[model samples]
Target: MKQLTIVGAGWAGLAAAVAATQAGWHVQLFEASNIAGGRARSLQQSFAGKPLDNGQHVLIGAYSNTLALMRTVGLKPDELLKRIPLDLRFADGQGLSLPNWPLPLNMLAGLSRAQGWNLKDKASLMQAAWGWHRARFECDLTWTVEQLCNASRLSPRVMTQLIEPLCLSALNTPLNHASAKVFLRVLHDALLGGLGSSDLLVPRVDLGELLPNVCVEWLRTRGADIHLGTRVSATQVSALQHAASADSAVLLACPPWEAARLAADIAPKWALSCAELTHKAIATVYLHCKDVGFNGLARPMMALHSHAQAPAQFVFDKGALSEQHGLLAAVVSACTTERDDVTELVHEQACKQLGLVNVEVVQTVVEKRATLACIPMLDRPEPFVAQGLWACGDFICGPYPSTLEGAVRSGQQVVTQISQVTHR
Candidate 1:
C-alpha cells in the first residue's frame, strides 16, 4: 500500500483520509489543533452547562458527498441530522416554506409563497432564475451576482429573505461581492435537483459529536494513524529525476493560506494558485439565556434582522436542552467592522429581538475568523498540485461556494486523482 500523509483535520482532510485509506493506502492524518473538526468543533462551557459548537452548521439532503461520508463512518443520516423540508422565517413575522417538490418548480413554489414579496419582486425573481438557467446552459462566467441582482431588479423582500442569507451562508461574502457563477451552481444542485433533495439537515448535537469525532473513531478502526495536534510546517519534494515513491504521495488538505505556505517550494505553481485564493471572516457569538419568551421560534434556525440595533445575522435556540441546562446561541456573519463591540451588541440584540426579557448573559464564545470568505469570481487553487502533493478544500473546487458539501466534494476529487495516479 502507498504511504500517504494528509495534513489538517478539517472536513476536507478527514474525508480525504477516509477515502485514501479505503482505497488501500496507508494514511497518516495530522491536525494543528488538539481537536479534529477545525471550525466545526464543540466545547463545554460553564455558562452553557453543556457542550456547545463554535457555530451552528447544517447540511442539505442534496449534499451527497457529505451524506456518503457519514455512511462510511457508520452514521445514519436520520439519526445524526434532523432532516426537514426547507422552511425560512423572516424577522418581520413573515415566513416562507417549501415542501418537498420536484426540481426548478420546488424553488419556484418556495419563492411564490414568500410573504411580503410584491408582484414586481416575484417577476424580478423569475427573470433572475431564467437568466441563471441560461447562463448555466451556456457556461457563461462573465456576469457577477451584483450585476444579476441589479439587472433582475430584485425586491428587498426577495433580497433579504432569499438572497442575502443564502449568499452569506454559502459564500461567506455579501451578494454584491460574491461570484454569480458559483451561486448559480448551488441553485442548480439543491433547488433544481428535485424533491427532498433540498431538505435542510441540522445537527441535533454539537458539531464535534455529530461528525468529526465519529470520523476519527471510524478511521482508527480501519488501522489508519490519526495524529491530533500535529502541524506540518513545510513540504519538500524530491527532484523529478529521483522518481516518485510510495511516500511521495502527500495530500495537503488545509486552508488556502496554510496550503500556499506549505507547497511554495515543492510546487511553485500550486503555491501561486493558493496565493491567488482570497478569504473573508465570519463571526459567531454564542449566548446563554436563562429564559426565552418564544417557543422553538419558527424553525431550528432563523435569520436575524440585519438592520436591528444589535444586528445579529442568525440565531438558534438551545431550549431543547432545558432538560439539563438553559442555553441559547446566536451567530453574526460577514462581520467586517466593530469586532470589539460585537459580543455586547449581540447580547443586547438577543434581549430585544428574541423577546427574552430578564435573561442573564452567562457565556459568550466568539469565533472572529470562523471561515474563509468565499467571494465570487476569485480564482481558486486546483486539485492536483504536484505528482504526489494534492490540494483539497471548498476553495479549491468549482464555483459551488464555501460550504461543508463543497469541502467534502473537493476531498473526493483529490481521492480520485490520487487513485488514478497510483494505479497508473
Candidate 2:
C-alpha cells in the first residue's frame, strides 16, 4: 500500500486523509494542537457551562464540497446544520431576506419586498444584478470590491446592507482591498446555482462536533494512524526524503507560516509566496444575559449596523441556534481592535441594537490571523511544492477565498494530483 504522511490534522489535513485512505492508501495524520478544526475549533474554556467556538462561522448551501465531505465521514448535514433561505434581515426587519422561492423568482421577490428600500434602490440593485448575470459574473482580476460596487452604481443603502457585510463575511477583507473577481464567483454560485443554493447553513452544534471530531474517529476506524499534539519540525520533514520510500508522499496541511517554514529549504519560491501571504483577524465576543434568556433577536442571526465604534457586523442568538440559553455571539470580521475594546464595543452595540439588558461578557476570542486578506490578484501558493511533497489549505491557489470549503477542496485536489502523478 502507498503511504501518505499528512502534517496538521485540521479540516484540510483531515479531508486529505479521508480522500487518500478511501483511495487505498495508508495515512499517517499528525496535529500539533491537542484538537483538530484549526481556526474554527471550539474553545477549551467554557462560557455559561457551554463551550464557545473560536469564531462563529456559517456555511452556505453552495458549499457542496464541504457538505459532501461531511457526509463521507458518516455525518448528516441536515441534522448538523439549520438550513434557511438567504436571510440578511436586520433586527428591525429592514433588510433583504429571500423567500423559499426558486432562483430568479427569489431574487426578484426579495428585491421587490426589501424593507427600507425605495423603488429607486430596488431598481438600481436589479439593474446591477442583471449586468453581472449577463456578464457571467466575471470581473477584472485587478479590480477591488469597492471599485465593482462603484462601477455597478450600487446605492449606499445596498452597499452597507448587502455588499459590505457579504464581502467582509466572505473574504474577511476590507472592501477596498478584497478581490472583486473572487467575490463575484461567490455570488454567481450562490445566486444562480440551482434551488436552495443561496440558503444559509448555520451550525446547530459547536465547530468541533460539526466535522473534525467525527472525522478523526472515521479515519481511525478505517486503520489510518492519527497523532494529536505531534508537531513535525522542519528538520524532521526534510529527513523524510531519505527515511521514506519514493512512493511515500508528505502533505503539509498546516498553517501558511508553518508550511512555508517546513518547505523553505526545498522549495524557496513556494515558501516565499506562502510566507508573503497577509491575513486579517476575526473576533467573536460571547455574551450572556443574567436576567433572562437572550432570545430577543428577530431571527437566529441578525445583521448589525456596523461603523467605526460598532465593530460587530452580525450577532447570533446561541439560545435559538444551539439551545445555549441566554448566550449570544457577536462577530467582528477583519477585526483590528484590542480584546478589551471589542468586548466593550460589541456589548454596547448588541444591547442598543437588540434591546437586551444586563448582558455581561462571557469570553472574547480574537484569532489574530483568522484568514488570508484575500486582496485582489493574490498569488497563493500551489499544492505541489516539490516531488513527493505537497501542501493543502485554504491558502492554496483556488477560485474561492480562505474558507472551510476552500480548505477541503484544496486537500481533495492534492490527492487527485498525487494519483495522476503516480499513475503517470
Candidate 3:
C-alpha cells in the first residue's frame, strides 16, 4: 500500500487526508498544534460566558468546495450554517439587501432598492452591474479593485456601503491594494452564479465543529495515523523520504511561511517566493452586551461605518446565529493596529453606531498574518513543490486570498495530484 505523509492537520491537511484515505492510501497526518482548524479553529477559553470563535469567519454559497468537504465528512452545510440572502445590512440603516431570488434580478432589485442611495447612484450601479455581467465580471490582472471600481464609475455610496465591505471581507486587503481580477472572480461567483450562490453562511457551530473535529474522527475511524501536537523537522522529512517506497509521497499542507521554511532545501526558489509573500491581519473583537434591548442588526450581519478610530468593517450578533445571547463579534479585516486598541475602537464604534451601551469586551483575537495580502498580480508557487513531495494550502490556491474555501480546494486538489502520481 502507498503511504502518504501529510504535514499540518489544518483544514487543508485534514481534507487531503480524508480524500487520500478514501482513495486507498495509508495516511499519516501530523500537526504542530493539538487544534485542527488552524486559523479557523475555535479556542477553549470561555468568552462572555460562552465559547467564541478565534475569529469571526463568514462563508458564502460560492464556497462549494468547502461545503462539499464538510458534506463528505458527514456535515450538511444548510444544517450547520445559518444561511441567509446576500446583503450588507448596516447598523445605521444604510445598506443593500438582495432578495431570495435568482441571479440578475436579485442583483437588480438589490441595486435599485438600496437604502440611502440617490437615483443617480442607483442608475450608475445598475449600469456597472450590467456591464460586469455582460463582461462575465473579468478584469485586468494588473488593476487594483479600486481601479476597477473607478473604471466602472461605481457610486460612492455603493462603493462604501456594498463594494468596500465585500472587498475587505473576501480579499482581506483594501481595494487599493487588492487584485481586481480576484475580487471580480469572487463577486461573479457569488452574485451571478445562479440562485443562493450569493447567500451568506454564518456558522451555527464553532469553526472546529464545522470540519476539523469531524475530520479527526473520520480519519481515526479509517485507521489513519493521527499525530497531533507533533512538529516534523528536517531530519524527519529526510527520514520519511528515505523510509518510504518509490510510490509513497509527502504532502506539506502548511501555511505559506511554514511551508517556505520546510521546503527551503527541497525547493529553495519556491520557498523564497512563499516567504516573500506579504500577509494581512484580521482582528475579531467579541463583546458582551447582555442588556442591549435592540434586536441586533437589520439582519444577522451588519456593515458598520468605520474611520481611523473605528476599525471594524462588519459586526455580527452571535446571539442571533447561535445560543450566545447578546454576544457580538466585530471584524476588522486587514487590521494592523494593536488588539487592545482594536477592541476599544470596535467597542466605541458599536456604541456610537448601534446605540448599544455598556458593551463588555470579552475577547479580542488579532491574527497578525491572517491572510496573504492579495495584491494585484500576486505570484504563487504551484502545488508540486518537488517530485513526490507536494504542497497545498490557501497560498497555493490561485485566484483566491487566504480563505477557508481556497484551503479546502487546494487540499482536494493535492489528493488528486497524489492519486495521479500513484496511478502512474
Candidate 4:
C-alpha cells in the first residue's frame, strides 16, 4: 500500500488524512500542538470550570462540505450542533428574524418584519437587491460592501440592521475594506441558496470533541499513524523522488505561511505563491458570569458594531455547554489594536452589555493568527502546490474567507487531486 504523510493536524490535515486512509493509503498525520482542532479546539479552564472552545464558531446548513466530513467521522448533524433559522437581535433593541422562505424572499420578509425599519428603508433595500440581482454579473464580482451600500438607496437603518452585521460576520473584515465579491458570494450562498441553507448550526460540545478527536479515533481505527505535538520542520521533495522511496506522497495540509517555509527547498515556485498569502488575527475573550442572567441576550451569535460600547463582534453563551458555570465567549475579528487592552475593553463592555457586573474573570485565550485574511481579488494557489506536495486549507480554492466549511472543502479537493496524481 502507498504511504501518505500529512503535516499539520488541523481540520485540513485531519480531513486529508481521513480521505487518504479511506482510499486505502497508509497515512501518517503530524501536528505541532498537542491538541487536534487547531483554531477550533476546546479546552477546560480552571476559572470557567468547564470545557470551552478556542473561539465561538458556527456552521450554517450551507456548509455542506463540513457536514459531510462530520458524517464521515460518524457524527450526526443534529447530534453535534443545534440548527436554527436565520435570526439576529441587534444591539439597539431591534431584531430581525428570517423564516425558511425562498432565497431573496426570506431576506425581504425578515427586513419587512424588522422592528425599526421604515417603509422607505424597506423600499431602498428591495431596490438595492433588485439592482444587484440584475446588474452585470461581472460588475457584481468587483463590488464592495461600502460601494454597494453607498451607491444604492439603502437607508442607514437597513444598512446597520442588516447589511453591516452580515458583512462583518461573513467577511471577517470591516465593510469598507471587505471585498464586495466575497460579500455577495456569502449572500448568494446563504440568501440565494434557499431557506434550509440559512439555518445556523451551533456546536454543542467543545470543538475538539466535535471533529478532531473523533477524527483521530477514526484514523487510528483505519490503521493510520497519528502523531500529536510533532512538527515537520523541513519537507524535501528530493526525498520523495529518491529511487528507493517508501512513502508515496507528502500532503502539506497547513497554513499558507507554514507551507511556504517547508516547501522552499522542494518547490521554490509554489513556495513563492504560498508566501504571497496574507493572514489576519482574531481574538476571543471568555468570561465566567455564574450569577448573571442573560435571558434577553441575543442568540449564541450576533454581529456587533465597532463603535458600540463593546469591542466584541460576536458573543456566545456557554451555559448550554456547561451546567456548572455561565461562560460567555466574545469574538474580535480582524483586530488591529493592542491585543491586551482590547481584551480588557471587550470584557468590560461585555459585562455592561450582558448586565454581568458581578461576573467573575474567566480564562482569556487569544488566537493571534487564527486565519489567513481572505482579501478580495487576491489570487489563491492551486490544490496541487507541487508534484508530490499538496496544499489544503481554508485559504485554498474553496472560497476567499477561511471559514470552517471552506477549510474542509479545500481538504477534500486536495485529496481528490492527490488521488488522481498518485494513480497516474
**On a 0 to 100 scale, what is the lDDT of residue 288 in model 3?**
83
Candidate 4 per-residue lDDT, tens place, 1-424, comes to 9888888888888888888888888998888888898778877553334477777788787887788898998988787797778777655556567888787778777887877777888788888887777763224555667777888878887777677767666767777777777777666677565568988788877788789999999999989998898877773444653421333778777878888888888778888888987666777787766564544345665555455445576677666543434677777777665766877888787776655676655666767677766556767777776566677888776554778877887777788777877666
Per-residue C-alpha lDDT of model 3 across residues 1-424, encoded as one tens digit per residue: 8899999988789889988999888899999998888889989876545567789899998899898888988888888899889878786667889988987688788877777888888887788888888888887879998999899999888888788899999999998999999888898888765788889999988888888999999989988999999999966776675565566999889888888888888788988988998999999998888564756555678888977898999888887888777788899999988877888888989889888777888889888988999998889889988767888889995766788988988898889987887786
Cα-based TM-score, every candidate: 0.90, 0.98, 0.97, 0.91
**What is candidate 3's TM-score against the reference?**
0.97
Alpha carbon lDDT of each predicted model: 0.73, 0.90, 0.85, 0.74
Highest lDDT model number: 2
**Model 2 TM-score?**
0.98
**Model 4 alpha-carbon drift over 4 Å, by segment:** 44-49, 135-141, 235-238, 241-247, 290-298, 321-324
Clashes of 1: 3
Mind giving the per-residue lDDT tens digits that candidate 1 earns over 329-360? 67667776465577778878877777766665
TM-score of 1: 0.90
Candidate 4 to native Cα RMSD, angstroms: 2.6
Evaluate residue 377 in candidate 3 and report its C-alpha lDDT on the 0 to 100 scale.
80
How far in Å is the alpha carbon of 62 misplaced in model 2? 0.5
Error of 2 at 32 (Å): 0.2
Cα lDDT of model 2 by residue, 205-302, tens digit = 99999999999999999999999998899988888744555578899999999999999998999999999999999999999877565445668888
Candidate with more favorable, higher lDDT: 2 or 4: 2
